[model samples]
Target: MKRLAISLSALALCAAASAQVTITEPWVRGTVPQQKASGLFMRIDAEQHVRLLGGSSPVAGVVEVHEMAMQGEVMKMRALSHGLEIAKGHSLVLKPGGYHVMLMELKQQLKAGDRVSVTLTFEDVASKQRFTREVQAPVTALGGAQPAPAAHHRH
Candidate 1:
């Protein structure tokens, strides 16, 4: 009976760990034929403070977390040197023209209605517990959420 109690306790702990965060609306843009790069977006609701370290997928040779920002007249997109922090009781949104996952050197093209698997690594800031959540993202077309176009045509 003591062993049974211990086993159940372990199972409960594992469930709690996985339940602290909820990832939703995971989607990737459909790439044109021969395109080697793409972006992935999603929403993460964290019950506890956590940092999104990185992501990986077999479809892409390299995966990175990136942030897009307007630097003066230039639209610059760069990888986040530090992981993105999702505060406790808050939601972090990864969308176009903002923070997102970049998938480069694709092994195959993503088509509309298709799905790809990605693993997002995260770490709890306090206890340092780390875990990964596997997300299946559907391929979607460009939506109205894109940022406004640059007002000037630079030569």
Candidate 2:
């Protein structure tokens, strides 16, 4: 009876740990066939404060977390090495013309209506723990012209 109780407790703890992070509305915007780069968007919610370590996808050879920022009249996209943070009770948004996951070195052409799978990694701040979840993204047509690379500043 004691052994059974312990086993049940462990199972419950495992279930609770896995449900801490949630992702929503994962999608990829479609681009021209020859286009080399594209953006991925999603919303991440967490029960506790956590940091997004990074992401991986089979569709692209390289996946990078990026942020768009303006510096002295020049807009630029920069790679985020430490990843984005998701505070408790808050959500993080990855959207067009904003913070995004840059999918580089495409393995196959992504077309409108196609679905892609990506895995996002999250780390718990207090526990120094990590977890990952897979998200499915559907490709859709771009709303307008592709975003241009951030302009260079000569200072």
Candidate 3:
């Protein structure tokens, strides 16, 4: 039937959309007992041009994509309201002191060695199709993946 064919076609499209993006090295920064916020880091690879719309996690009341930059003599952090773009075949690295996921209003403390679930949403640049990928990010110590001193310091 025509309806069955159409349904199968739509299912194929959905599968393709979800397969175009891949995530690796996903992690969330460990937070102190009373800390209300933390950061999540990961590497995203795109097989097609897409935009990272943002993400959500049950552990945090609010989740957003943020960028940290040096504005003159002071460092500034701001959310990327328009989302981030990734070219086809390229990758985006979400790391500390750069682009990362801000997890605010935590429901509980995220300690090292724990895992959290984060669902990232993305939109295909050409077709405007949207999809989501759920990733399990391990909680690493605050000093886990810093720049030079990252490996040396651990609590």
Candidate 4:
């Protein structure tokens, strides 16, 4: 009984530690059955300045942090090669036509109401502190989600 209690206490501590970086309103865009890729959006709030290193999921073979912005009249999309930084007390929102998580080589299609399990990795900018958090996001309609397309963005 003591061993069980200790194990449960340890699990609780781990849950609290993993929640240091709060993930809110997490969601993945709906994709066609044949689509191979999709986008994920969420808001991250941290107590200290931190960098979003990267993330992954069982649904996709590759996951990357990406950005979408306007280059003159054309829309440009690319990976955030060095990761994205979130300042202390500031919430970093990942949405379409902005900073978002790109899921490539998806193993299956995602529809409305579906849940996605995502693991987000983070690193403290000041102390190089590292941690990861798991998020369960529900899929929403194609145009129903917030943080839609925008023009012009600077790194």
Number of the predicted model whose TM-score against the real structure is largest? 3
Candidates, ranked, TM-score: 3, 1, 4, 2
Residue pairs that clash (backbone atoms under 3 angstroms), model 3? none
Reference-based lDDT, residue 31, model 4: 86
lDDT of 2 by residue, 86-107 (tens): 7888878788768888887777
lDDT of 1 at 28: 84
Q: All predictions: root-mean-square deviation over Cα?
A: 7.8, 8.5, 4.4, 6.5
lDDT of each: 0.81, 0.74, 0.86, 0.80
Better of 1 and 2 by TM-score: 1
Candidate 4 residues 9-110, lDDT tens each?
A: 878755655655778777888888889998888888877788898888999888889999999999999998889998888888898889999989999998
After TM-score superposition, the amount by which residue 5's alpha carbon in candidate 4 deviates from its true location, in angstroms, is 20
| Candidate 4, position 62, lDDT | 87
List residue ranges in candidate 3 displaced over 4 A: 1-3, 146-155
TM-score of 1: 0.81
Model 2 regions more than 4 Å off: 1-15, 143-155
lDDT of 1 at 90: 99
Q: Per-candidate TM vs. native?
A: 0.81, 0.79, 0.88, 0.80
